[model samples]
Target: MPSVGIEGPVVSRGLDGDGAVEAPPFGNANEIGWYRGGARPGAAGVAVFVGHMDTRAKPAVFYRLGDVRPGEEVTVTRADGRTAVFTVERVETVAKDDFDAQRVYGQHKRGRAEIRLLTCGGAYEPEERSYTGNLVVSGYLTRTGTG
Candidate 1:
């Protein structure tokens, strides 16, 4: 997983659940802590990153995740000192209550590495309510390096 200090920035890792890491507030917008996963940034597999869009009273780090657009470039810097660049292929918003975690977090057959940035989405519920769904930014690995 990726590590961050008080000045921590967003990064990526494997979903294997071995590394001790933290995902800084999305876009450096807040202080909420999230997990960046365990997969090596550029490795051939799915790299999952999860964060809260908002808490009970305050907006969480990933509130603006839905703003990501297709064809946009996403960079995943690995703890091993390698950085991977991915091109966003698709962006989907799924209801938080209706999302199938297995299909969303499950494995993929693509040869290139894929990363999913997830957070809450849709209209916020007022009573017996919470986030309506999730905003997902899916991208395919395009490049990797230190710089």
Candidate 2:
């Protein structure tokens, strides 16, 4: 996603025992994690991508994810050599405590291939050492090409 200065291989990930998606190891901060249990990119459902905003010492692959704006494009080059381009529809900062999992990760359209780029955002709470919310960028497939 050049629009947000993101470029890296997506490692397949799955849900943990508690049913929450697993994140890439902190050591691999430069890589993005894809929820493999869900719809594949360019398929007719929501595809999720997660990455870290920053590592302990420096910014990570999705450090600039929140900078992406509506109307901008996010391109995903699939492992099968096809490319799917999506147009940014909305960028939201959803509070962690108030997050709606279905709303944020649900398909936007019945037959459209959509995606959500997610990373931590909002004010940092020192006591918890965690962000207050998450940055969610929702987009739908707009173009496809064989790369």
Best model number under lDDT: 2
Q: Tell me the spans in candidate 2 whose CA falls farther than 4 Å from its real position.
A: none
Worst 10 residues of 2 by lDDT: 16-25
Whole-model lDDT per candidate: 0.63, 0.90
Model 2 vs. true fold: TM: 0.95
lDDT of 1 by residue, 1-147 (tens): 111111225543333353323444345445433344435557777777766666666666666666678887777656676878878777888876677876775545557688877766778778956667777777888777785
> Scored by Cα lDDT, where does model 2 land?
0.90
For model 1, the run of ten residues with the poorest summed lDDT: 1-10
For 1-147, candidate 2 gives per-residue lDDT tens digits of 786678988999999787767878889999999999988898999999998888778888889998899999999989999999999999999999899999999987788899998899999887987899999999999999998
Score candidate 1 by lDDT: 0.63
Off by over 4 Å in 1: 1-38, 55-59
lDDT of 2 at 70: 97
